[model samples]
Target: MLHYFFKIYLKLTGWKATGPVPKDLKKFIMVVGPHTSSSDVFMGFAFRSVLKLKHIKFIAKQELFKPPFGFLFRQAGGVPVDRFNKNNFVDQVAEMFIQNESFAIALSPEGTRKKVDRLRTGFYHIAKKANVPIVMLAFDFEHKEFRFAPLFFTTDDEAADYNKILTFFTSVKGKNPELGLEHLLN
Candidate 1:
């Protein structure tokens, strides 16, 4: 019911997903990039629904789990995580992949809505630690499309891997173009 509703909603809004869908994989990290606006949450939900990926989950800063919008985030499959604290986040999340037969978490590589000098490394580390593939999901607001790059397993070379990730997202335009990840391309 909700899936069909969102499917129609996306179609009506002229938003569609491009590239391949990971239907076979049971566990992996879905990296959604150029998260320049909060509206990306709704689009993320719409894409999750339209893709029929029920296991897709997200993590937000613990602050967002507070009053008012907190309940909404929780209802949207959000798990509040402490961003400031190291707290062995990578190991903890990696353990989750080990325990669950099927788990997929979508994370914003930018780590914040505002523009940054470089992309965060947590998502890559999580994928490496969990021994799962990384799938790129770009919110290309310029083209009004959600783009997916083919899933790829992480290698021992971190810098080279990040280069690949940046290459895939360089052309994507976020809702707030100025706040997007284009700067990282330099």
Candidate 2:
């Protein structure tokens, strides 16, 4: 019931996923870029429903797991993080993948809903450590579409790998396009 409701909601809002989200790969990190608004989460939920994806998990602040809405978020595969205790966060996330038979996490490379020149690189490191490919998704507000790019596999040359993945986001416009990295978009 909820799946169809959310799928219908996405269509009502004129939002549709561009292509089939990769499903053959069971465990990987999904990178959604230019997260400039809180609505991104809702959009992602709708997108997931539209795409019929149920196993992808998301990381959120520990505080959000406190009360009424916490259960809802958790049911949707929300993992809580204690930002104050930043020790081995990447390891913890990687551990989630390691422990699970199949898991996929979605997070913004920018790390915040604000302007950023360079990506946080944490996602990259997590993928490398977990031995999984990074699935890139773009919230192209300019085109009013969500676009999925090719999966990125890290090579020994980190710089070259990062450069190649970063190029895929050059033309993508986020909710706040002005806040995007000029150098990156250029």
Candidate 3:
């Protein structure tokens, strides 16, 4: 219903979705990266709609679940997470995945629109513990295209995996100049 409408809207607009459909229906994690602006939300929403992906969920800050907007967030498959908590969010998410068996949780490794010293490693940890592959989603505003890279398997070498993930974002062009890697990672 609403998802179908959004998919049509995105097609009418300039946004394009390119990616591989999931082969396995089991649990998995999606890593959306180089998040640089509010537009990332719109783009991600549009992509999700286009894919017609049921059971897809994203983790958002708890504050975004306030009244009026809370319903909308839930409607769009958002799960509220308290970012300030010292608890093991990764393990918690992994447990959820294991319990659900069909869960596909989405996260922005960048953690915020602003630049950061390094990408948060929670996505990797969750995927590894859950024994699920990662689906890499990226937005190239300059090209007016959104790409879905092949599912990535977490390796023993975390740094190597991180570098591989970073390589995909290297060619993506964003409207904001500050979205470059300098501000993205330490």
> Number of clashing residue pairs in every model?
0, 0, 1
Candidates in order, TM-scores: namely: 0.88, 0.88, 0.85
lDDT over C-alpha atoms for residue 87 of model 2: 65
**Top of the candidates by lDDT:** 1
Residue lDDT tens for model 2, 1-186: 878898777677777667547777799999887687878888888777778677788998889998878897799889997777756778888888899989998988888887776889889889999899888888887877888877767889988887776787666877777776546733
How much is the lDDT of residue 69 in candidate 3? 78
Please list the Cα RMSD from the true structure of every candidate, rounded to 1 decimal place: 2.3, 2.1, 2.6
TM for candidate 3 is: 0.85
* Residue-wise C-alpha lDDT for candidate 1, range 1-186, written one tens digit per residue: 878889888888899889998877899999998898999988898888888886788877789999988998888888777767766778778878899999899999988899898898888989988899999999999899899999999998888899899999888988988997667765
Give me the runs in candidate 3 sitting further than 4 Å from their true place. Answer: 61-69, 82-86, 182-186
TM-score, candidate number 1: 0.88
In model 2, the worst 10-residue window by lDDT is 177-186
Which 10 consecutive residues of model 3 have the lowest summed lDDT? 177-186
Ranked by TM-score, the better of candidates 1 and 3 is: 1
What lDDT would each prediction earn against the true structure? Answer: 0.87, 0.81, 0.78
Q: Give every collision pair in model 3.
A: 117-186
